[model samples]
Target: MLNLEDLGEEGFLERLATWVKTRNPAVRISIGDDALVLRDGTVVTSDSYEEGVHFSRLYFSPEDIGFKAAAATLSDLAAMGAEPICFLLNLFAPPRCEIDFLKRLYSGMEEVCGRLGVEIAGGDSVASDKLILSCTALGKTTDPLLRSGALAGDLLYLSGFPGLSRVGQQALRRGVEGFEDAKRRHLRPQPRIALGIALRGKVSACMDVSDGISTDAGRLAKASKVKLVVEYERLPRHPELLAFAEQYGGHWDSLALNGGEDYELLFTASHDLPDCIADLPIHRIGRIEEGKGAFLEIGGELRPLLPKGWDHFSK
Candidate 1:
């Protein structure tokens, strides 16, 4: 009954623009071959990746490397409740790196690009001591969601359960069994693209929990000038994360909150939720308060869980 090509590129956009005309009244230009479109306001974000720092070749295949790189970049756009449309890539590779390495990386990017329906508009490549990949992503949203938009009495939510990535990393490094979810999480973290796009005006504030919950929640609190309370037990910890945490030292909890690659959308809603906010397993894990007392609660007891999320330049 429905097809993408029924309208052509320009006609499809015209139809889409008509569909969202009530929300984004500013999308004056869109689709068509002769002329492009524009909006009064825009949101843009950029991210970078280095060989030894972000990932290791011994663990991540070249294709996975490219997918992760592009996914990480596009994930930021999702946090703003925007649909990723175009992205640019810049790569720096060492002389010793083989050509297959680069092509495979692009192949992985191509796979995700197909899924997102985005194009690698343009970028640059050069020689270096190590691999340095950077991406600048573009998104379309007249009303871009930000962390500062949250308010008191709002409910805090996460798009999916936590600690899967932690489990995945452990499974890969320690050969820990019973970690398929974790392994898949680590190998292919899917940013909640549909959920984010649907959130648009429905969510008060939004962000991707890349660096973990405690850290990212703290950022939301600071930005909104309010307090964030996360219920630890209510935090839908992956079914086996506790066991993995026991076997992996304190790293499991650490990874769950600060591991820096989960790529799930963390958001706040001012009132009741709707069915459109679907895709991942959404959970109402916490709430916002009037003060600056950002902390976490376990069961019924409240405690302070400092925001020590991953920061590349921190001391």
Candidate 2:
């Protein structure tokens, strides 16, 4: 038997996807990108939040866990530029867990679903030794934006500043005070659904920055068969990230490039933005060139970026 840890998350996923693709010809989009799109125009994605792995009761409330879990699946739909229709939840917990705790979790999911105009279509509940929450979001799009559509001469853009969540997680772990914004970001992530909707016809390729730009950019580059050159100084770091670096002696650039869980949309477009794209909150950070692999340019020096983003199996 092959050890899953030896493959890492990406390698394991790629191998699994390759096997599944050979069996199912109807799969429009499979395992490589953020979500899977079917030929019938249905876009589906599922993500899970595990106890101790994704969150801890020490820093997150039941409501926060539920909300973030929903966001994880919804963010995938957003990356595909799909309109969310409904969400289905799979919850597993110890039998002794309080009913109120479960209610609070449902309340959190309801809050996010209400805001996103998505309906809770029902789900299954099972008893387990530990708390596990998983969500499956269903959506639809006429023309799904894919990560393989990028071309040379395309400009790269990010929906918003990165590293805020990383800074927030650090603040929470270190018990650092006065970074409420950062903490809130970590607790409650805002998926860029509206921005994805607006970018439907404009962008050549799109994906969410859940695994940090350093890794996700390479995924995009590999899928599109182009080279991505990101200018280090052009990366927009959150104000809280800068403050965290100043007070904690950490590198903000490192966090912005390598830290995961931002959920911001990363896309590529032509040199000139359409009038529709001009009004959206976006930052030009890089360019796509004719080549392979992703590189970072710092002070006029270019170097290939190592895969330092999140990996479930790699410690």
Candidate 3:
């Protein structure tokens, strides 16, 4: 029998996508991208976190774990420019885990759901050998944004700075001092919900930077059927990441490009961007062109820059 371990996440997704035999008329999107879209303009996404694979009690608090888990799912809705509606939380925990921890975890998710006006519908709970949590979110919109709408000559923009998540993760792992901002960023990433809503009918294509820009950018490019020429120098670097690089010994730009879990939005628009939206701190990082792949321009030299982001199978 075929096993999940044999194909890794992406490989498994690819094979399963090909095996889909039926296509539902109500399903606008399925088996790819950030979420599934219904014909009724509802967007749904789900994500899971395991005890050892995603977090550990040694570094992440129960509350933080709950918060980040919700954020990951919300980020997908944001990518589709969908408005918050409701969500379901599935919990899998060891027999010895604390009840208080579960309470705090639910409270953490409430912190975000309350702010975003999301309702906790309901979910399933079960016993397991380790703590595993999943969040499945539902959203609604009049017109949902897609990743395959970019046309050649559109300008690429980023909602916020990158690299802070990686810096934060490193700081937490090493128990570094005086990097509270970085640590906070890693512990609780804010999804660009407002920005995604603002981008409706304004951008040609949109997606969130979950698995690092280098990797996610390629996915956007391929979906849009165009080549992206990214300007490395123009990529925004957060001040916290700069400080982290100065204090430690690592290349800030390289780290930013390869780091995952940033949860910022990456999008493309025609040159005629609106003044208000363009005026935002949105950084122009690249432009789309007629081609089949993505490339990076560093110091006037153009070269292929494939994704070196996180991959479950890439050991």
Candidate 4:
């Protein structure tokens, strides 16, 4: 029997995707892309966050857990350039879980939802050995951004810094001091909802950086059937993360490239874009070309940019 460890996450998903066939014409986008885009402009996406896997009680509070879980799910909708309407949350918790803890978690979700004018429609709950939160976000967009729209010569852009979340996770895990900015980024990531909405019809393609630049860029490249050459030096790095690396001795470039869960926007455009969108600075880090796979350009050399980010079955 083929093991999940042998297939890995991408291989397993590729195999699973073959079994999924969309017959409904209303589904503009079915198995592929960030979210499902319906004919009536309704965009939907779902994600699950499990304790110990996605988060840990050592670093996350009840509020942080709920907020980050919801933000991660909503980020998918943002990738599709959709405005969120509402969300449904499914909670799986142990019987011993405190009511106060659950309430505080819901409050955190509400805080993020309120900022985007999203409502918690409703969901189901069940008792489990561990805690798991699943969120399904609904949104709408007249022009949805697809990962397959990228073309040759399009400039690649990334909003905000990467690797801060990984830095934060390390800091907390190692009991290191300072790096407050990095910790906050990992704990309460702000999804680029407005930026995605603004990118409609302007960018050639887009997606959120939930799985790190190397992995996410590869997905975009494969979907669009093009090559993405990313300049290693151009990848924006947070000052805090840089300082952390300098102090603790870690490769900032590797972390920035492979660190996942940044929840930032990674996009491509064929034309010149403004330096900032709604006051958010966007960095042009690379360009698309007629080829396949993703590459890292450094020291006048090109190297394959493999997916080293989070993979559920990579063991």
Query: Once model 3 is optimally superposed onto the true structure by TM-score, how far is the C-alpha of residue 174 displaced, in angstroms?
Result: 0.7
Residue-by-residue lDDT tens digits, candidate 4, 1-315: 999999998888889889888789988998769999999999999999999999999889999999999999999998999999999998999999999999999999999999999999999999999999988999999899999999999999999888999999899899888999889889999988999999998999999999888899999999999999999878897898789889989999988999999999899999878889967889999999999999999987999999998888998
Ranking by lDDT: 4, 2, 3, 1
Number of clashes recorded per candidate: 4, 0, 0, 0
lDDT by residue (tens digit), candidate 1, 208-268:
8877787678777877889889877667767667677776676555666766578888889
Best by lDDT: 4
Please write out the lDDT profile of model 3 over residues 20-95, one tens digit for every residue: 8656788888866788889899999999888877776788998999898988889999999999899898888888
Q: What is the C-alpha RMSD of each candidate to the true structure, in Å?
A: 12.1, 1.8, 2.1, 0.9
User: Model 3: which ten-residue window has the lowest total lDDT?
Assistant: 272-281
Please provide TM-scores, in order, for all candidate models, with all chains considered together.
0.83, 0.95, 0.94, 0.98
Candidate 4 has an lDDT of 0.92
| lDDT (C-alpha) at residue 182 in model 3 | 76
Please report, in order, the local distance difference test score of every candidate based on alpha carbons: 0.75, 0.88, 0.86, 0.92
Model 3 local distance difference test score: 0.86
State the displacement of the C-alpha of residue 265, model 4, in Å, after optimal TM-score superposition: 0.7
In Å, residue 7's CA in model 3 sits off its true spot by 5.7
